[model samples]
Target: MTTTPPPTAGAIDCDIHPSVPSIEALLPYMADHWRDTIVQRGVHDLETIAYPKNAPLTARPDWRPAKGLPAADVATVQAQALDPFATSIAICNCLYGVQLLMSEDIAAAFANAVNQWMAAEFLDRDPRLRASIVIPTQNTEMAVAEIERWADDKRFVSVLMLVMDENPLGRRLYWPIYAAAARHGLPICVHAGSAYKHPVTSVGWPSYYTEDYAAQSPAFHNMVSSFICEGVFAKYPDLTVVLAESGFTWLPAHLWRLTKFWRGLRAEIPWVDRTPTEIARDHFRLTLQPVDAPPTAADFERLMEHMGSDEMLLFSTDYPHHQFDGNAVLPEGLSPALARKIMVDNPKNTYPRLQ
Candidate 1:
């Protein structure tokens, strides 16, 4: 047998989802009343749910678990993602608070189960693994409580939020969660996923997954714009937000348009002390994967130039999802230093636990 080489300078995957099949496994550890609701929703098998044809492809073609390691086992995860460049993997759960429209109680319970399981199983088993604590945005109090409970766990590096929540992320209703995140020095990761109760985009439902995929950047732009204009970033300076799975190309144009609008409307929101672009540059980071346009390296470089900061771009392989392409999709011609920052340093800075 030939010997395989050890991993090179470690890379940290800033975005990935290691899905769990059933909420039942977690139920035994969850609060009593919440178990019934989790079982009813069939929270298990969430990964199998098909995206509407309009949704953008996000999974890898052969992305599934090895035959028998526990779903949360680190060894199983290594089998799926252990690459020479990847030293650590940060996962975001699939069936978290996106179900809030179903029932606040059910959403809150599911959030609790996912967090508890992640902390006790995955995080506990692997020092290199990290997770985002899912919280029910529909109920800020419970969300804050969950954040506070998991805040100190080094492995729980951030709070995961669905992009299409009822209230724009900037609303006061969501401040409690931000406050909790800030208090604990954790960032918030907003990912685009099934918007069960909320519409996927303002442009109306798309006819195919490709259309839906194309619309994700806009959805993210809108939410990020809301947070900036509403003074979310101004109020909580230390708080950082990651826009995951949405390609980076649209950011420059979105920031330009938002800044222009903010300039004209600045007087209306006296608390927003900076331009939308400035706030975005300083406080937000975005993961790069499933790039929607300019599939070529030259085009990607131009996109990054427009994005303004290399630090703001993080490497991600939306692993196991059909659209992921391991390392093949990372833009070509990136300098080793710049590539290292996107693959490792940037994430280390954003998710402090990795440090």
Candidate 2:
């Protein structure tokens, strides 16, 4: 299989995963009580099924470690993701199972520990590293508090929330989290994963991991529509929402369908004053990886034309994940100007802290 070359020098990678080596790694960051609780209960690592250990999609073969987890340390990320891509800044969107805890208190505790672990183990060790503040979406008050807790740390470029949560992202219950993110000049990075509160697909649970993984695009459609139809952009005009690891190829078609329905159902959502496509262009940005493009470069350019904006795609290696082969993080057929936007300009604009 052929691959395109790495992105331009000094690219800003918008999505890279830094796995927690183990629950033991986070013990230092957690309170004594929580640590004791974990030990006493014999709690296992928070790794989720979203990225199974042997799954090719979870880690590129060369990037995987012989023991323990891939991207488990700062050095590995520097060598594999940052250095190879010539990343000026790379945002770590750790996808541990902090959101899976049923107890809001435990979820919040783990979330805090994860952020602290990120700072000490990753960001503090690498000047080029930035992170998303992972929050427990199970509790809005706690989620906002987590955002506030890390807002002053400019290394945190965004707030991370799973795409599949207790409820659709657009509901008023989730607005406080959005408000906190906007107020702190942090973008909301809605990444592809599930809290497992519901089935990954609308048609109940899928039979295979591939089915669950493929379902992420449609899930993103639900999220984008929820944000628009629920008037999230109207209320948070300055907010930016980065859809990390969500493929961009499906967007133009999805927005076309949404805008068509909105034209007829305008009265149902009065606050959505503009077309869904326009709203998405203004407030939504998507990471560029797992480029699910058509067969040819010409086809990709045409797809870009349909997307209607050059400013919406941020470059991402997706780190240890097997989104692409070798150092060919970018897809072919991109104009130099468009490549520049994806690698640098668009990410800097979308992530306030990056600027």
Candidate 3:
């Protein structure tokens, strides 16, 4: 947040979205069967719970393309996000509808088509761009297969997921997907969202999108807890995990509570030898957009101190989704060194391919 620090030159934007133009654009990447299935059934694009196409928060007014959906093309993305921010490298995380289906096979097919489309349309066009390998969380087998398909591409730096999934992320059933990702040195990027398979709350669904958005903090807590207690980091010590668009202001208290409880509950999970905070601090990284810090810079600094690790944050504009006014994006109160870490060093460490 040091405003006078060096400009974001040679910096990495860890999360910027490029909206999928249309279902038709993905047809070329789809398998023949799915292509026929879609046409035959007259299936429309599945709207994602995370970002509705027309939602106010989905696209900043100025960033919207004149002729098409916001960020639906490479040129618009470059002009709006990359060029203006002086970003040297921008990682595109497309939040498409490939994961909303009940049928794992169809979901897998669409996920495949989406990744293929991303490679062909985005990554292939921009040398400065990298992308997350979107997977069908419904089927771990297909998910792992998708990972193997793009694992060798240094441009596909991480595996993306919604914060809430069909099951607890720490379950052993999901470990195969994690194993494959770790094998390829891909961090799991859990964005703030859900498939809406279940109600967002423990009791039931929420009344509105505002509730859903604010509830993300708790969801992230449970998600991180599941990963820690389930021994994901313990199992894959070298792996990194990124919480994209995840407002991390709540992390300090969550981790502190978990660690305090962990001491008494040590016997339940012997494999989790270290405290939850230590493990999470070592393996987890978060995006900096929508930082949700205190109003004053001093209070924000106090929260940063509470987080205990400088490496936990990686910079992101959350482009096309306005979290700040034009150009004055960096949060205030960070020391020159921490600002550099968030903008450059932390991301490079989180994503090995970035180096």
Return the TM-score for candidate 2, rounded to 2 decimals: 0.98
Q: Which 10 consecutive residues of model 1 have the lowest summed lDDT?
A: 47-56
lDDT of each: 0.71, 0.93, 0.87
lDDT of 2: 0.93
Arranged by lDDT with the best first, the candidates are: 2, 3, 1
Count clashing pairs, candidate 1.
16
Model 2, 1-355: lDDT tens per residue? 9555455578998999999999999999999999999999999999898999889899999999999999999989989988777788999999999998899999999999999999999999999999999999989999999999999999999999999998999999999999899899999999999999999998999999999899999999999999999999999999999999999999999999999999999999999998999999999999998789899989998999999999999999888889888777778889898999999999989988888
- Tens digits of per-residue lDDT, candidate 1, 1-355, equal 9756432236777776765645456777667666665566555433322342122343344444344212345565666654444555655544433445467776677677777777776778766678888887778898899898887777788888877677677888899889989888889998876544555667567676666656667778888888987888778999999888877778899999988988898899888887888889888998867566576778867877888888898877666555545446466756678877888789888876667
Which ranges in model 1 have alpha carbons more than 4 Å from their true place? 1-9, 36-58, 65-73, 83-85, 94-98, 293-295, 324-326
Cα-lDDT of candidate 1? 0.71
Question: Each candidate's TM vs. the true structure?
Answer: 0.88, 0.98, 0.96
Order of all candidates by TM-score, from best down to worst? 2, 3, 1
Instruction: Put down candidate 3 lDDT per residue, 110-184, tens digits, no spaces.
Output: 888888888898899989999999999999999999999999889999999888887877888889889998888
Winner by lDDT: 2
lDDT of 1 at 321: 51
Model 2, stretches more than 4 Å misplaced?
A: 1-7
Q: Which candidate is the best by TM-score?
A: 2
Which prediction has more favorable lDDT, 2 or 3? 2
How far off is model 2, as Cα RMSD?
2.6
